[model samples]
Target chain A: MDISAFVLFWAAIFTSNILLTNFLGMCSYLSVSREVESSFGLGVAVVFVLTITAALNWLVYHYILVYFGIVYLQFIVFIIVIAAFVQLLELIIERYTPALYYTLGIFLPLITVNCAIFGVSLFLVIRNYNFLQSIAFGAGSGIGWLLAILMLAAIRRKLKEKMVPLGLQGVGISLIITGIMALAFVGFSGIVQIQ
Target chain B: MFTIIIKDVTVLSAIGSLLAIIMVIAQRRLSNYGDCKIDINGKRELVIKGGNSLLSSLSDKQIFLPSACGGRGSCAACKCKVISGGGPILPTEKPLLTKAELAAGDIRLACQVKVKSDIKIEIPAGIFNIRRFNATVTEIIDYTYDTKGITFKFADGEKIDFLAGQYVQLETKPYGKVKQGVIRAYSISSKPEINSSLQLIIRYVPEGICTTWVHQHLKLGDTVSLTGPYGDFFLRDTDADIIYVAGGSGKAPIKSMLEHLAVIGCKRKMTYFFGARTTKDLYLTDEMHAFEKVFPSFEYVPVLSHSEQGDGWTGKTGFVMPYFKDAIRDPKNTEAYLCGSPGMINAVTKALIEEGIPKDKIYYDSFG
Candidate 1:
């Protein structure tokens, strides 16, 4: 019996949410999720970069790493693929859609180091996902990260006006909220098995 | 082990070569730019390759415009009016342009606008004169605990002709732990008569990118790049009694103008009021006093805001502006030259205006 693409996709998004459950990309999530508007912008940017890089990394891994039998070099290969893809994407975006590029600004460079992108690629390869399954899982993981950040950003904006305790004013309170959200997401773990 | 290593290297090199070849082919076949021409202010025309942005295109032809961010489009400093041959205005340019700017023909960020076709752009006349200079650090002298006076001698150019208070941009190359070169603006501290070299009075701003490079990384003998003579702060040509007020590193341009007056033998009556928090902040008292002797009508007034215990300060007390208000016999006829932090400039300007000096007669260069 084989796990279907749809099952893996939903499982990766909810039960094994990369941000809340595993906490893979907490740095940018916390820093950029301060404002709802900026968070939405960053979220969309992450989704776009993650989906494209995942597919590109898959191609590189299968064609280059596997062909050379240097599977140990997967990490380096994935990083280089992600960086080059981001640079090419930046040039294309500047030429075709200048507006989106401006809004991304310095954040575009930040996307290259984003952990969620590498996480998605690594998981797809480890799970031996077929091309269709990899695409579905990659896009689903990005959507999951997007949804989690949007919720966190809205909560953070509301908490700005409210009295926050001295010790938990910034990242401390955000981490606590993330822990609670992870437990809530655990409710969906029984619905599907990812690995 | 050597065999495995050789195989790994061979594979990597093969992949690199393949990518390079593909890139070259794509660049040549896919990215070919056709003939393009650019018209400047309905006065001149330039013909060049068509694909690159207007900023780099203009720069290639030696038409320099002020772009502090190096055509990254992040600064929005390189804006030009594209009256014709400009395609749709880009979204990147919208944030920098006002509604009035957009309505008046076509205004575009030069870095963002591609030269897909021949274009006409309206550029300021002053931008035509902006030039890059190769200079060497001739001298570096400490003025205060945190301030240093740096002088750069032009390698080839005999003189840099500039207004008394205008600033020049210094390009600091990446050294030691730094990564990339960056451009930072500083007011020219040297008198205009000595045109072969440029001097700047820099105050250390802790952890500031450009200042840190200048203070820690720059050496006395190394060469550096500079472009300049920007800004509109200068002494107005008038016979009225002059009031010059400055603080901290803001002393640069004011010192230049005062030295300029002595060099030109101008006999206008001038009172220079220098404000400092303490005695340690005061510098060049003897030099200023010498200027007063040279020009019999000039006076140097150093005001201390917070006097020390054993400093034995015997000068005007309190802020510099209030002292000017009490001492000036006729405020209405005085032309003021001010350079300082934005807060100090605002306070002094407000006080001078209240004292019957016309706003037009008062010129200021503020570092915000």
Candidate 2:
């Protein structure tokens, strides 16, 4: 509760990279990283959903669940909230941002199952962060996921022509690359401890 | 301790009740739009409660438009012409529709479009007969490594009156991470007279939603949801000689039509050119041979396109269409019903038309 918003933000990105650190949303990260443009679109959508849902979930937990003394139901409540939020976000995005919707296309609905969004909310609750800290944590965690996927997408684009070994092709090579990236991000943990 | 536990339980129940009440309130307040009338092509009118998508609203009223993605707007298959009251086209539907289609006043994806008011739309006349049947899977027989013949019997005394060569959407309950039921279309292989049951020949495409479910998770005696007798692929009632061509799992509707012809005892001369790569790829050979016995003028031609001579194969050795060219010297008086992969259908259709079969005489259904 005493954590500064800036530290929470930076820590969420580097020390607690959602994709690399927690492996919270590997499904879409693996599927959508084939193209930079589509990955970027999905990344942006995830950022939007994470930021909003984190804040919304925090409010629902604190104001409703905590006030009513039903904190044990957080898991079920969080999932429902996330699903509904994703649906509403899809409607709004499809209505207002047609180009983004086209770029995201089929990847938009896949966000409902993207664990990073729920993970962010659960992390905020576990950390017992204030509203501003929760928002920063959510937005930063999403940005962290986006950054990791975009980097992977760029590597995939470059490696498209390269003849990967049969054993290391497709998901095999992707996991190896992700492992290296995870190691690289480990250096940032020395500078900041999110916990 | 008991008091604390009771307090906790009571509080949890109270919160749950409150949330349920809120959801109910939201449903009544947010979803209500009074009674809405949907006028289709100035012919049929449906009066129903509003605030749902036109696709689902129409489906609820027993009018089924072909939608592969279950109103997710991903398939873009459910396009209807909204002559009026459709409002502005949303961005989601723009990619699927053409400028000409938009100019012709097509409004939006029926799934994406909410019917808040009385609306007038034009759906194809064929959709009127589409009904959702509650059928139980009575039999499942393996046709090939990837393909299976699934037969669904109607609930006692319930039967669907559908023509041969029409397709029905099979619904599969979500398994694993999939949380909702997904529906996919399969051409009905059963003849119309066999009204008590429906048969579908499903080939499992790896990672394919419905087919994978049907192949792996589906079982006999399980209730399945189906909507149809949809699609424009059916035998044309003409006196001309019929050339029926099909390959792989594309044999469903073709089989249906053949069974139908046998049942009706039609005496018109017909040749069914079934193409396969090997013996394993071919199925229902006995059924086709049985039809040959029943329909004296009908012949069953199973052509192996890539069969090795040493494999003890005596069938025609070439692509089915070229063999068809040699078989049908004069197609001017022939009506061709072609069903198969897109490549096969396109190549065969072109060859048939070039061989003097009138363009109008050739009907095809392409499986992408």
Clashes of each: 0, 0
How much DockQ does model 1 earn? 0.28
lDDT of 1 by residue, A122-144 (tens): 98899888877888788778889
The sequence of per-residue lDDT tens digits that candidate 2 reaches over residues B1-368 is 79868876786666556656665665566556799999999988999887688998988888889988889888777888887777677656767788888787565688977787899998887777788889999999999888899999877678787778888898899887778788888888989889889899999888887887899899998998888888888987877888999888889999899888877878788889998998778888888988878986878899887897578887776787776766574678888888888999889988887788999888887775
Clashes of 2: 0
Q: Is the docking of candidate 1 incorrect, acceptable, medium or high quality?
A: acceptable
Q: Which one is best on TM-score?
A: 1
Structure candidate 2, residue pairs in collision: none
lDDT of 2 by residue, A1-195 (tens): 777999888888999899998988998999889889888889988998999999989998999789867788898788777877676666555545645655675777789878888889898899899999999999999899999999999999999999999999888899999999999999899987876
